[model samples]
Target: MTVIVQPTGVSAADVIAVARGDAQVEISPAAVEAMATSRAIVDGIEASGRPVYGVSTGFGALANTSIAPERRAELQHALIRSHAAGIGAPMPREVVRAMMLLRVRSLALGRSGVRPVLAQGLVDLLNHDLTPWVPEHGSLGASGDLAPLAHCAIVLLGEGWVLGKDGSRLSAAEALRTAGLQPLELAAKEGLALINGTDGMLGMLLLAIADASHLFAMADVTTALAIEAMLGSERPFLPELHSIRPHPGQAASAANIHRLLQDSAIMDSHRDDLAHAVQDAYSMRCAPQVAGAARDTLDFVSVVAGRELVSVVDNPVVLPDGRVESTGNFHGAPLGFAADYLAIAASEVGAIAERRVDRLLDVTRSRDLPPFLSPDAGVNSGLMIAQYTAAGIVAENRRLASPASVDSLPTSGMQEDHVSMGWAAAKKLRIVLDNLTSLLAVELLSAVRGLQLRAPLAPSPAGRAAVAAVTPFAGGPGPDVFLAPVLESARAVVSGPELRAAIEEAVGQLR
Candidate 1:
């Protein structure tokens, strides 16, 4: 089904569908009407020689230098060509799709003074699966993601390259022909409208928010597995205990752990057992507190994503009363803050998960289990080095979690000062997400192996389902074999839908 991009009704979920789900998009009739009104405003200014920025004059430091009427359209083309100065490997197809989707959505709001055909051009690319080759770098996140979005705008003019559906690089002209679409010529203010918005960074932020939501739920499932593996009690997940704190995420996470550990045979075996310090380590006891805080952070970031989805973020936005006004809505500071803050929460989640892996590797800490979860201990090295890998990734995540928003630099010959380093923040946050997935995979497999050694003491029904789902990845565990492939398979299980689906089958959907 196609997603309709109405001026004020776009949502973060819509971006995800168009970017990652192969959904075509269409601009709403209302948006077309709104854009026509705004385009009329730009045409009026052009005829009157009004000094409207980005309409009849130059950009950035040269905004004072007026462009001639005969050459104003060329100025738009030159802006697209010169500002498309991004360098580096292409961004992922999904991110590029998201960038294009968001760009069109913003313009559809009728504030950017762009021709409706300009907005339709982006939808055509998406409908035909023609992704412009947007480079991964070059967005300062001030005055929008200018350089990166300009690369996308260039493809619309048939001057640059686009990634064919088969992923082969093709000239934009060639791709347009294959898709049965024509290249659009630049119009006064249309090129600026195409590129001048916070679409790129916002797209990445929305993707990250969706990922964080998944991890928050999956974090609880994996945490429950570790608790049962440690022979730890589930008393900390008591409804009364969570109720005292009253954080929605904390309560939800605590409830999930309690539900997943329901009807546990291992827990029954430990019902009479005490003096396991009368409590598990903070890694287990405080799992909800730590992971729940990450969930809460995601909730906050989702709000920001929701607001950005429908905003008119272009510069010199055309007002309803026919005035063109320059605004700072293009600054990526809000998105930068959200990305950095989510990175910190995700890093902490991975850090705690890594600690659980360490505990499972040590004989003194692991109780009846052999050191490193190895049957042959000193001879095999079992998962000893896997713990090292998780620690390495967790450390990297901490370093990447540093705030990029605080590192603003001046650019545009100092005409633009205090740039939001949002592009970098969103980029590193993706690194954190991938690494955290790998790290959690390690913890999940370690806990699964520990519970297997416990044998006749079956885990909870939900825990059994989780273990069964993960066992095929590690081949049901054994004396050490080739461990790297096993971990990779486990990572696939953790990062994909299989593990969650398998567990949900038994538990009937997690919170």
Candidate 2:
């Protein structure tokens, strides 16, 4: 199915589908009409001899210089070539596709005074599975991901390299020929229109939001496993206790844990027993608080992302009244701030999960589970070092949590004095989440094995289902053997969709 781009509205889901799912994209008729109006103004501005910021004059530190009409076309090409200054590893194919899709959608809003052919050119590349070789660095993120977007812009002009569908390399010109498509020649304002936006940062932001949402849901599931396996009482998760605080996320998380632990033999087994402790540790008892805060943070991030989705983020935006005006909407502070905040929240979530894993490893702390969950204790030394691995990752997350948005370095001859560093924050957020995925899996693998050791004691129905989901990947309890592969498999299960479905099969969809 095609994702239709409108003049001022595009949904995040649609962007993801087009970028990651290879869905086709098209500009709506209204958007096409809007572009026609904006383009006419740009043409008039060129002919009237009134220089626009990007149409007939120079850029950045050179904005004071004006050029003649004959060299105006060359000016656009020069902007792309000079600004394609990114340096670092090439971005993943998905991120590159997202950058292209977002730029096209922003252009479709008709605020950038671009021709319909320019927007069509981007869609053509996407539909043909031609991904520009965008590098990972060089975006100040204050000037709308300038350097990174320039690389993508050059590909459209058929001067740069691209990665084809089959993973082979080809110059954009060669790839265009193979696909029976022609390269685009930049027009009056098309160069700046194509490159001036927060699309690169915003695209990664959208993808991060999606991944964090999934991990938040899984946090509830993993916490449930840890609780049942460690014999942690479910009293702390009672709906009555959480209703008073009334943070939406806290209430939801509490309710999810409550539902997930329903019909549990584990809780019932210790119900009347006096020997069992009255409370679980903070990580086990306050699962709702830590993970719930992350949930709430995600809500804020989504709001920010949604606003950016419909924003016209170019400098010199073409207005509804046919006026060209330079605006600060191109600054990526909003995205940078959101990305940093979410990264911090995700780091905390991983930190708490690591604490839970530590508790499940110590035999005495685990309330009678075998040491390190090794079948033979001393001889096996099972999951003992696994806890260390989780500790190491959690430690790294703490370092990565230092917000990237707060740091700034001047660029463009100090004409641009401060930058958002949003792209760096985004890059770290992706890594932190990946580490968190594995951390969650490590805790979950320990929990699954610990639960199995209490066999015939049976877990909550939801906990039982969670164990079932990971058991195939992590295997049933036994002496330590090939632990890495099992944990790796468990990591895959945690990051994938099946684990949620497996748990939901027994309980309803997690909150």
Tens-place lDDT per residue, model 2, 61-156, is 888889889988899999999889888778888888888989988888888888999999888988988888887888988888998899988988
Clashes of each: 0, 0
Q: Compute the lDDT of residue 216 as modeled in candidate 1.
A: 78
Q: Estimate each model's TM-score.
A: 0.98, 0.98
- Candidate 2 lDDT trough over 10 residues, lowest sum: 161-170
RMSD of each: 1.2, 1.3
Can you give the lDDT of residue 86 in candidate 1? 88
Rate residue 14 of model 2 by lDDT: 88
Error of 2 at 14 (Å): 0.4
- Whole-model lDDT per candidate: 0.88, 0.87
